[model samples]
Target: MERVEPKTADDAGARADAYAAGPLLNCLIREVAEPRPDQDGRRVYRLPGGGRLLRVRAGRRPAEPEVYAAGGWRRVDHAELVKLVSDELRRHTGRANDELPAEMIDSRETLAALLAARDAATAPDDPYLRSEQCLVTGHPCHPAPKARGGGPAASWLPYAPEAHARFPLALLGVRADAVVEEGDTSALDALGEAPPGYRLLPAHPWQLDLAAPALAAAFADGRLIRLGATRHDVRPTAAIRTVHAPAPGGDVFLKFSLDVRITNDVRRLWRHDLLRLRRTDAAAAAAVAAADGPAAWLSDRGYRTAAFAFEHLAVVVRDGLREHLRPGATALLAAALAEGFDGNPLDALSGPAVWWPAYLRQVAPPALGAFADHGVVLEAHLQNSLIAVDADGMPVQALFRDAEGVKLLPEVSRSAGLLPEVSRSAGWERLVYCLLVNHLCEIAGALTERFPAYDPWPAVRAELARCPLPEIGDLLTSPTLPGKTNLLLRWTGADGAAARYLPLPNPLAGG
Candidate 1:
């Protein structure tokens, strides 16, 4: 698809505002507001906390927000919307937050910069790469999905996936004795050669810049030595920290620590998570292996880092698509499918009758089966999942990654010392949120956007009913599904891993 350029600064700002407002509005509507009857062909809602009425032109992406003021509705631009949200949230939660409003503004500014950068830069030719880089409005429910830690645009634009950025990784050599590593990290040795006394560890260039101050001591003491950059350019994936590196031998993905907060937390590969990577990855891999069909797990094979600056300099080697993906199938990010992009397979579908079921067949079974049979709760959210489509643009396989988010029931229950019922309930809630609410809900919404009269949930219900898990019965009968409260979580300064969910009307029920 050809890039559309805004004619002026005002146009860019307006476009950015509309883009930024969608998720913010989604959060506000879902979390803080109570629904009111539609007014003037627009959906209306009551902001109970602020005791005001809000309305917006509604669809998957809500827009053109207006709030009742002085006697009539007044248009709420991005800034005003942020203010309205902050005020309503403060009253609703009885908690004041200064950080989130700034993030909301920062997210809009970041989008404006991304829009300009995307227009100027050429999009990647590879469909997979295109899909990976195409999320302009990320995490449709997130309050500040694009916020880059309130950093200047110039600092992050070069590394932004939305900008279709590709650059060589900064090669760092750690003294062999100072190297801390686990799992199959032999891939690092191939990226670049290290001196006899050191081992090579690839670092994201932006991370190197962010951690420069802390790393100075290591550099001075010869614990770390710069070996320059790699020969090949690595494309930044949707997860800014992870990069796809093309190689003659085999393609690989290198996930590194990025200090900047993208969505909820600083996107760092924390030491605690890294320490348990092997066990989590093994369970997920085994679960995927046990499931029937072409479902695959893009294993976080291993990691390597400097002992001195572990979290800051650590890099994770993830299994590439070529090995896990079906031979002739093209892998596309599920988020890209929802977000729309050039060459998106969903765009070409004439109808969802056959396509929707086929899509669900490939995507749903692995996640549900993994949870029910193997006791593995996969974080099968849109961003972590990839749908591999055959030559005809029909989904054939599903690939899931990111072991950091996987939860094994036995381990989780044991560690938390919870009753079986409680552990199961927690796991099911998490799985439901990630797999259905976060992943499928977005894709189904995107499909419905194209085919307005098409109700996509019956097919989803059918797919769910096919799963023999007992949770399926309750899921289909339940009135609500767990929707993660990202805005409140961030507003309350809760840990990113400490997920909090509110009930959302479950479409899969009683259809």
Candidate 2:
């Protein structure tokens, strides 16, 4: 909620110090091998690694503050900061308590405390400068620093100095019924050439914001998406994108789905399908009973979701390197997402819950009897997860998509009296496929290639060792199937580099 601005090098430095309040052990200024100068007489310090920098710039809360990068400086404004920080904290903490209490505080308060500690540890003898300080080089912006890249791209194009910026919500004007075709003309080129109505303008958050509508209209009467005449058909990238507006420092993505119907979709899908279908709710309650447990461990951590909307989701804009990450990081991330859950285990001795058993346990008559006879559950497989990473190139958060293939647990046998047999059978089929073929294979496969040092399944076993249910840990390490499964990857191709399937234990051996 607080915005800090500093005009001179000294002022910026002072603000940074105040923000840090102490030197951060995890934070270090990475001096770009070569420094670049900015238009407004500032030195851009590009820190490649370590924690985030509490950057402050001259001006009244600049719309987008200039960010220090290797190439030079880029604009990342206040709005951008809010979105980047908010999304990251949410994903890392995996809980949504935006307003951190003085006690058990995690996100915002954690950041504030870290900053304060960093400021308090600053060296008093450090050289003073009229301009702000740079952690990487331990220097201030020198007049006439060498120029870096061609002057920033034209406003129409996107740029990011930090990891946060705006992206074009280009709503091209196309017929309501028209479908998007490949190789359509470039929307960017067309917008630059067009005049007046055809001109491309940056999308405004308010312009797209909407409140939840009547029950029937939200889903039953939703409008078909109409294409724009000059639309760019680009899907979101695994890597976060950074965009800039004409303004000095532009806003970041801050969208809120005001539609309650949309929010309800999230609840039904996550709470009912994933949580309830697999008995995670029961497991959660159980863990709370048996001293500190996984569910209890993650109890009060996460980001914020503003007011409820009928059907809504929000996005933030940021500027950072968008590239393939290191293999080690990918493995760590994939395992984190899996949370030790596997469809099959190799060793019967290990005691973690198998995917099938969890489903069966959750679908017992007592659990399903409460829902209206018509309620359905969706099974979440690997493909459905969309992971968002932070600066370290690690996955700390995930989004589960695809809702049509919902179903019931297999244990729930259907009787023709109240519920239709077809609905029950269909639900069971979806659950089996999702758990066995879809979620299990994809995640295990990725882990095999990503991490060769230690078995990913075994690592999951290690984490579960601390769980309240040690028997569940034993089940996890045990193989559910009779023989070796051809699941591990074998390096193949001309250079024997491509990966192919090989046989490995079903679940890891020994609990």
Candidate 3:
């Protein structure tokens, strides 16, 4: 285990506190806390349930947590902040979660360890890889976004993307007779060779270690054989389960099933999802393929795993960014761009006049087109979308990934007028949330943060108006847009896939 020096440990804790505070503050503002007018150039919010006045250095990543108490404001560090959040959540939800509060603290500690480890780890030279690995504050809204199931630092630190870790895949040979795979998983064969009677199956080393006990029997029975690691190192992207492996011409990416939970749910590529993977992937791929211009889909090619181990060892192969990205354009994680990254182009953009509209052009068309023409509601959230920018730091192309989140028309059950005031169907509402609220709002906010003079919503409204889809008119005129209430959903212990949303101000309404 690599030890953090005393001085480094102290620095790490302080830095981690700020990085960890962003998501927690976002949750509080969105759910439990009501924001008051700016007070003395600082953001002030009333914690309704706790009846405490909280103030912070405002903006996207709110920091310097302070609570007003006994007529004097006192600072709260990450530990105390977690306790406050726990108390507030308990009062607000009228429910207590023993596991969640600890997880929040562990997430902060994990950030500290990641900060310590990143000092030693070398970052990738590729800009795309840098953008992918650059999310120190992973998810902008999740309470414990970086918590790796509260495991020891030694277990997950080496595999942490935030630390810029790169490692080779652990190759395993499953007996040919027991090999189970679907779609175009032929890509797996090229990773490494297997013995005459076996097939090549690359496993995530961390996952392999976690599943060792379950896989021991298969190893002993000669159903699975250890085939050592891959030839080259694969770097983890923002989604820790997915990795980028360099290859000739264009690179190939692989996503593995890890049992440990990340932001939400167990990150395992479930069996049911795998079975329907082809249909979902094809829908997204076809949707993008049909769209005009530079919009692309990084297709989920296929997956390979052992029949005996199944979900425990499954690995899904996805098309690399290089294959889909426009020539001379650099692809970046949309979320990293939204939340500031190391070399973020948003920081470089002179104003929103050119950049914001260019971004809207790249991101919106395909999503709306897919819904209108192909009946595919793409989960076009920040993490799933990649913005490929030109030399001028202007978005030139939009590349989308992940088929697991795609909701096809046939499968979408429309429930209208469920909520008394909302007249829109559920499917349309979800599309609006994923495309507008989740993806566009943060991006537009980032642009607005940089260029406060420009209101990016008109351009957003303009882009949607250009789309021929029937929903555009109503969307532009609607009074409210659905925003996913992640904090409440998680607190209520709902299934992660089960989305619950609340009404938010419609930026398109010109309010």
Residue-wise C-alpha lDDT for candidate 3, range 406-438, written one tens digit per residue: 776653222211112222366678889888988
* Model 2 per-residue lDDT tens digits across residues 33-104: 123344455333333322333343322112234454576655553234334334433443344433211111
How far out, in Å, is residue 25 in model 1?
Answer: 0.2
Residue 28 lDDT (model 1): 89
Instruction: Give the residue spans of candidate 3 off by over 4 A.
Output: 1-10, 411-424
Tens digit per residue, CA lDDT, model 1, 1-511: 2122234435778779888999999998898899999999999999988689999988777888999889998998899999999998999899999998999999999999998889899999999999999999998899999999888888889999999998989998999999999999988888889999999988898999999999999999899999999998999999999999986567889899999888888899999889888877887898999988989999999999988998999999999988887899999999999888999998889998898999999989999999898888999999999999988899899999999888878654354343232277899999999999999999898888889899999999999999999889999999999999999999999988889999999998788
**Candidate 1 local accuracy as lDDT?**
0.89
Q: Order the numbered candidates by lDDT, best leading.
A: 1, 3, 2
Q: All candidates: CA RMSD in angstroms?
A: 2.5, 22.7, 4.5
Clashes of each: 0, 75, 0
TM-score of each: 0.96, 0.25, 0.93
* Ranked candidates, highest TM-score first: 1, 3, 2
